[model samples]
Target: MSNKLSIVVVEPDRERAILIVDSLRAAGDFDVSVISEVTGLARHVSSRDPDVVLVDLTSPSRDILEELTLASGPLDRPVAMFVDRSDDSLTKAAIEAGVSAYVVDGLRADRIKPIMDAAIARFHMFHRMRLELETTKRALEERKVIDRAKGLLMKARGLDEEAAYALLRKTAMDQGRKVVDVAEALVTAAGLLS
Candidate 1:
């Protein structure tokens, strides 16, 4: 497949929308699409599978923000929202709704490229952070399960902590399973018996 970045622009104003589109076209080798309608925007975005989405609005309502969230958050596409004016509360709401970039009264042709670049970069950074958080959480949960299993083994067999861990390791090696798998199995069995 071509390595060009795909971009989708949702601009209600036809005249101003062209300005943004033209700017993006000038930025680099970008496959750009502009949608004049706001209804079913998420579905359209899903079908397009754009790398980034730019939403230009006079003033965004809650429903519009929600639609943008659904379009960008679930689809995992970076989005930049340009508005004529915005308050602190709305800005906070936009971020909460998963808007990567919320620009207020700052829609210049020259700035579109950088804003889009920043949006994409921020989205990727956040995505990586989220993945790391999930992995850390899983590791922590597995550690807790293993600790619980080790405690059970120590109490039942009158073994020391190290001996309990060794026994669990030995069982896991013999069964050709992960330590977490064996630990989970033991914990489940212990729970069932009690």
Candidate 2:
């Protein structure tokens, strides 16, 4: 467990996973751990919070892509893929899914060593700045969404500002979603139906 940096490899092949771990450890840059599935990776991300995620992907899955996209987007976590398949569509989807670096098959110590360092460093730098920006933007956006939803609630349901806010809060609580999420849904539905 290196305090400096960590990378979780999503390789299901026990042999390849071990090899990747050895190679990465040999690089002497990263503390590498392997997770066999997306669920394991999610838990690893939440608990370990690795500086960079190196997913050894053989194919694509929509749920994984969405999770990766959301994890990388507002959270600004950096994820890269050690991909076996080079299909154009898969590459495009991986990029879209927030995989920062898509390394092809030739993952030698010398070739991928520097890349691993650079990716981890850049991911930390960019992730920090992106997190700050996203926090500010989220706050501002939350206010706007809540205000819009409140306005709609007052106009359509004849409620005061406090009552409108309460309605939004109640909906969020009942649905087990964030207040901002509820507000956004209200705004979208209003736009569509009203």
Candidate 3:
């Protein structure tokens, strides 16, 4: 019921972590927690279930990047990573790990709000794209199954495609199920009999 954004800041340095927390508080009314240790980062972040995560690192290693990837939770939430310096490989790795906003030497108190906003926006965009892709894939699979069922009906009952589809749709309406479900069942049964 609370509208406050819950944020987790991962920083190994105590002083820097405090600074980041203060910056977030100054930016807005945010509920923030800081995790100073890199060990078991995934567990810590998962336990918090934050709306967003901010990871500030002086230099990130492959192991740390891997930990960050796991901590991001399959892109469940937005993650902003600020690094003092980074190379092409590190930047690529961070992006691949689902860090929505990857900043190189741009971690300032003044920039926190905008960076956070961008990260959240990017996360939403990617999430929407992912959902659309899944829906498209599912629909394509359903179409294939329905076509196979129609093929079976046309061959077995000597009916045209239109008639076969009409039978499938009528059965689906009578059974109060989706056309895809009925088609899938028919396909499964045909496979079994064969």
Candidate 4:
């Protein structure tokens, strides 16, 4: 349980890579690993499971960006990419690809700490937004199921919406289950019968 940030650097340039590694180590308490080799870099980063990933490339190709995007998706951590030069389209693609921070021509040892901090913060904010979206989606799905079940009850038993909902609540309480669970069961059963 070390209170140190684990960092993985992917820089093809050996001199720049050393500088990046040195900067991170000097900035704060960090467990830093540098991958000079670009081949299978994403898999190596995944294996390390670093808290943050720093990619410094002179010029990144589309294939490299895609690989990085795949690495940062689903089981994503913070990713900071520093490029020598980039176009608007490339920058947009990087943001859409889940890059926490994309800095163009802003790779300096003195600036690494603050940039890394910003990247970590951005990552956390994105994570929070994703969680909120997932929670909202689940709630919406449950509501839809409950509404469908209520409609089915209304059609079958000539019950009003309130009565149908009450029945669901009562059934849930009696069965020691959630209203959503009961509603889901009813919906599933109705679907099967239909």
Candidate 5:
């Protein structure tokens, strides 16, 4: 389990996703979770915290590419792009969109298997340091979330820090989640209701 690699695959095509999954599983000890859209990708990424993300596409769309790029942080992992976009402008956009490894046309998965494996291995090598960075980022984001939740709770229920935290902790314990998770949930809920 400790030696296993987790990867999030954002490929819209189910068959291609399976091919990548099978190849990766055959090549290394990888736990692959495949998804189609960017929505909820961050949650999967933040929770699963995969070592790398393999995003396969025939071309680069401004919105989707940008979303995938922004996902790198919460994922705290490098992105491997298996693209068919051969246009120079789009290629440039991909690089600026946070693609760590961008492979253009004429590069199929089999031909690039070794490179992908190496990239994934390198990602794991830096996983610890990346985890530290993500921990710091998460802590900072948690502070902001908790503060917002606390403010809402205080305004709505007149509670102090200790009481607000106690509520959050109890909610987390009951739900078998982290206090930060509860805080985030609360904040999200507040945002929706307000």
Candidate 6:
């Protein structure tokens, strides 16, 4: 991937958006787009396919936060929201909505780069955790399928667990498929037979 990051600044105020864009430009060479209107925000942000999103709101409402949740897609990219002030409930809502970074009373030109960096890093950390979780869940599901297949073989062919697994492995090797795939097929066939 290129080093240049495509950023989308969602600021209703034109002047503030310009300042944020200028700060980003000063930090590094970045592809930045500004969304001044909050209407159809999801479409605007998605169209840009930005690497990161920076939202500046004077005082965010629940409705706006919901809109931002749809627009930011916290899992897809890092989103840093800057607000003048906030309460516990609003802060909780923002984090729950998948905002990577929620800054309160800290939107200065000098602080922009560091905040952006932190948001990206935090997002990556969460992304890695999510991927690892998905991998673990998939492995567990595959193990269950394999065990079911083994049980079916043990009952039908009077084979031991090891022998049943060997059969599955052999079938997978012969077919140029994964052991899990063969096991899944066996399990599906057994289910259909029942």
Poorly placed runs, candidate 6 (over 4 Å): 1-109
**After superposition, candidate 5 runs with Cα above 4 Å error:** 1-128
Question: What does each candidate score in C-alpha RMSD?
Answer: 15.2, 16.8, 15.2, 15.3, 17.8, 15.4
lDDT of 6: 0.63
lDDT of 2 at 65: 35
Q: Provide the TM-score for each candidate, comma-separated.
A: 0.48, 0.37, 0.49, 0.48, 0.35, 0.49
Residue range with the least summed lDDT across 10 consecutive positions in model 5: 97-106
State the lDDT of candidate 3 residue by residue for 21-132, as single tens digits: 7765766787888887777776677567666566532336224544443334464443335433344544454455444333223334344444464444443454567789
- For model 1, residues 2-79, the per-residue Cα lDDT tens digits are 766666766676765576667656657677788777677666765676655665323363245445443335535444
User: What digit string (tens of lDDT, one per residue) describes model 5 on residues 1-194?
Assistant: 56455567666667655766676677766677777665665455545655555653333532354344443455244343544444455444434443333333334455445536544443343445657999999899988988888788888898987898888889899999988888888889988998
Better of 4 and 5 by TM-score: 4
Q: Positional deviation of 175 in candidate 6, in angstroms?
A: 0.4
Candidate 2 TM-score over all chains jointly: 0.37
Clash totals in order: 0, 0, 0, 0, 0, 0
Over 96-190, each residue of candidate 4 has an lDDT whose tens digit, in order, gives: 43443332223444444454654344434545676899999999999999999899999999999999999999999999999999999999998
Residue 67 in candidate 2, Cα distance off native in Å:
31
TM-score comparison, 4 vs 6, better candidate: 6
In Å, residue 66's CA in model 6 sits off its true spot by 14
Lowest summed lDDT window (length 10), candidate 2: 98-107
**Which candidate number would show the highest lDDT if scored against the true structure?**
3
Please provide, for model 2 over 20-111, each residue's C-alpha lDDT reduced to its tens digit, 9 standing for 90 to 100. 57666766666767776655445555456555456523235323633543444565554434443434554444444443443322344344
Off by over 4 Å in 3: 1-111
Stretches of candidate 2 off by over 4 Å are: 1-125
Location of the lowest summed lDDT over 10 successive residues in candidate 3: 100-109
Is 1 or 2 the stronger prediction by TM-score?
1
lDDT-better candidate, 3 vs 4: 3
As a whole number from 0 to 100, the lDDT of residue 160 in candidate 2 is 99
- Candidate 5 residue pairs in clash (backbone atoms < 3 Å): none
